[model samples]
Target chain A: MACFLVPTTEAIVTTIATKIIEKKEKEAVSTELEQGVELSSLHRERFSVKLNRLNHLLWGGSLLLAFEHFWHGEIQPFFPFLTAAGNPADWAEALHEMSTVGVGMAVLVTCVWGVHTWVLDRIAQREGMAQHEEQARRAIRK
Target chain B: MTLLITILAAVVTSCIWYSSARARRLKTGVLCSMFWGASLMWLVDAVAEYIELGAAYFTPAAQDMLNDAFLGFSVIVLALTVWVVLLFVKDPDGVVRSALHNQRS
Candidate 1:
């Protein structure tokens, strides 16, 4: 019932990390610009972009799942928030579900995101290669 | 039932995202991931329940099925609401910004 909490926790951590990293990235960019160093893309996406994608996936999924849990009356607006908190037996079951279903979901989402980032990187690398080839061919013709 | 519904939503959103580059501006990928993640979570839940209940898992009560269907539909609505809010805030087309400017002028 409280399975969404796992991803919600992950999202919170990632959100904080994104904010910190984003600040650092902006500072780095400014320093590079001040040094008159030309920043090249190399067709590679920024780490922040990839992190944001993971953040989006985690946050959006957690939010929707939380809403669904609320709809099912598993969650309450009151203290404890979870219906399973009322009793020890139910609490134990909830914990079991959290460990199994919740953890599984969190891990699954992370794995999917990892694969997605890998694919994007591969695509970007291929694009960079093609651009390099095109430039080389143009230079030869010139 | 919720699993089925979410899987369908994920497939539909993914198809839209893949077919239309314009949809990327709307950030349909967020919706796609949300639905797909939910579907996967539900699938795991279903499997766990099957293990616990064995053959009885296949014969869920009618009321439970209805409840799941409602929950699935509600989840879809909530996801759409979130996506819409994001779109409005981002205003990728500058629609809101231009509207405000027009009004001021």
Candidate 2:
């Protein structure tokens, strides 16, 4: 009840304040920039999309596992909305124990994935440098 | 469950088969065939679990056979990937030289 009341009060105040604060849109924005310049001509951040995907997948999987198996009972009564598997009271200890295992596993997997990425990046970079050198050699030969 | 499993297995096999078949002219077709054939055998085992058999001759045979087949093919694929990565690393300079020459020509 306190959580609900506090947030509601805050929201109402914030909404009224927002209405009092006048907001205006700019009519015209003029900016000039040179065209025909390659974006990659600047130093680009080389990011591995695979690693980002893997991080998202790991986070989402852990969140689902924690919610379904760990926080099943307690967080439900306050909201009175979430469906739980059963009384987590009996299994709360078990859930607490499993958290150690889950976090340990997540850390271990993250390390392994990091190692694999490091290997891949190092190999890719070495190969790329080798290619650049080869091209330079050919240019000199020409 | 049986039907769904069979369909999923079929899709996987089809993909492996397609990739294997589309390998360059120099590449052998044995790998693709072996992989898909073994997967089919496993699918048959899964199907057998749902099936009611009066005769006991081939009842337990499917799983045992498929298990051995999966083990064999997986080892072969593992060795193949190792060999390919090794090959790529081995003649790195020569490959790069040829690549640059081809690009220039």
Candidate No. with top lDDT: 1
- Give per-residue lDDT, candidate 2, residue A64: 26
Whose TM-score is greatest here?
A: 1
For residues B1-105, write the lDDT of model 1, one tens digit per residue: 888898999999999999998998778988887887777667777888899999999889999999989988988998899889988899999999999999999
Instruction: Write the residue-wise lDDT of candidate 2 on A1-142 in tens digits.
Output: 0111222233344444434432211111111123344443332223434344234324322322223222224335444342332545635644543354433444443454467678877887787789779999999999
- All candidates: interface RMSD: 1.5, 16.1
- Among the numbered candidates, top DockQ falls to 1
Worst 10 residues of 1 chain A by lDDT: A37-46
The 10-residue segment with the lowest total lDDT in model 2 chain B: B24-33
Query: What is the lDDT, from 0 to 100, of the residue B16 in candidate 1?
Result: 98
* DockQ, cand. 1: 0.63
lDDT of 1 at A94: 87
Local error of candidate 2 at residue A42 (angstroms): 7.8
